[model samples]
Target: MTRSFSWWAALGRTLLCLVFLQSLLGKMGGFGAVAAQMQQRGLPIPAVVLAVSMALMAVGSVLVISGWRQRLGAALLLVFLVPATLVFHTALEDPQERIQLFKNLAIMGGLLLVIDREAPSDRPVRR
Candidate 1:
């Protein structure tokens, strides 16, 4: 039973790793265009935010894929994704936009599932 659980956990982690890695690659490849889009959208701190996000996604994906410090990597990845889901992928009046919006939401839901078993509040907080 334990062995089966381990296998399933590993498979789930692998799926998450692949998704995160591909997303990181896409973001890196289109950094310039994303920055331009941010600017067009009148987003504040466009360049700085994009640069930080690129770093977080790239490095965090690598760590998550390697299963080294996975919890930390997942935490970092969520920081970028939560805001991205709200800011960039919000549902608008267009069908295409709604699809994109739900895509991010779905990804976020997957990430939440793949994260540490205990929610953050379940962890001991140090003063």
Candidate 2:
């Protein structure tokens, strides 16, 4: 790959993980309220769930951003994404929830692409 391509690949990975990064910061900033929201949503042990979610977001985003074990990172995020989408974005009557569901689905598609993608280091260098 050309140097330009490498730079763009890195930027794409970062963009793919931007949502997770921003969400991790948001959750950290509003821990109590977020946990309470989770509790209200019928999640068991909201605090523990929130903590685990935060860990997955932080670690998964880092792994994806760094392009190290990126598939594993995307998988971890998928684990978080599936349930969160089902539990939180299920109100089809609400247009906003509908939008969010589709957005999460789109992110899932991107993450799957990440998982399927060959690592840059694994690719043969072009002359």
Candidate 3:
């Protein structure tokens, strides 16, 4: 790859992880609020789930930004996003909620692209 391409790729990776990195502060500082939100949604073991999700986001963001095990990082984000989108943004009656749902979906799509672009060796072998 050209030097410019390398620089752009690094920038893109950092930008992709920005959301997760920014969220870490809110998640860490407002742990009780996040847990309460999950509990209100009727999710089981809200505190444990919130903790695990925060950990995954933290680790995944680091991996993605550093371009080490990026596919795993993207996969972890995707896993967290899928359920989060469904559980938190399912209120079709509220326009704001609908918008948030689509935003999450778009983020999921980007992560999917990241996962798909992984190196061939990073992918599982076909039978």
**Ranking of models by lDDT:** 2, 3, 1
In candidate 2, the residue pairs with backbone N, CA or C atoms under 3 Å apart (3 or more residues apart, or in different chains) clash, namely none
Among the numbered candidates, top lDDT falls to 2
Q: List all candidate RMSDs to the true structure.
A: 5.6, 3.3, 4.2
Q: What is the lDDT of residue 123 in candidate 1?
A: 72
User: Higher lDDT: candidate 2 or 3?
Assistant: 2
* Steric clash pairs (candidate 1): none
Task: Give the residue spans of candidate 3 off by over 4 A.
Answer: 1-5, 120-127
TM-score of each: 0.72, 0.88, 0.86
Top-down TM-score ranking: 2, 3, 1
lDDT of 2 by residue, 31-126 (tens): 999999999998999999999999998888889888778899999999899999999999999999999999999999999998998755778889
Q: Which pairs clash in model 3?
A: none
Better of 2 and 3 by TM-score: 2
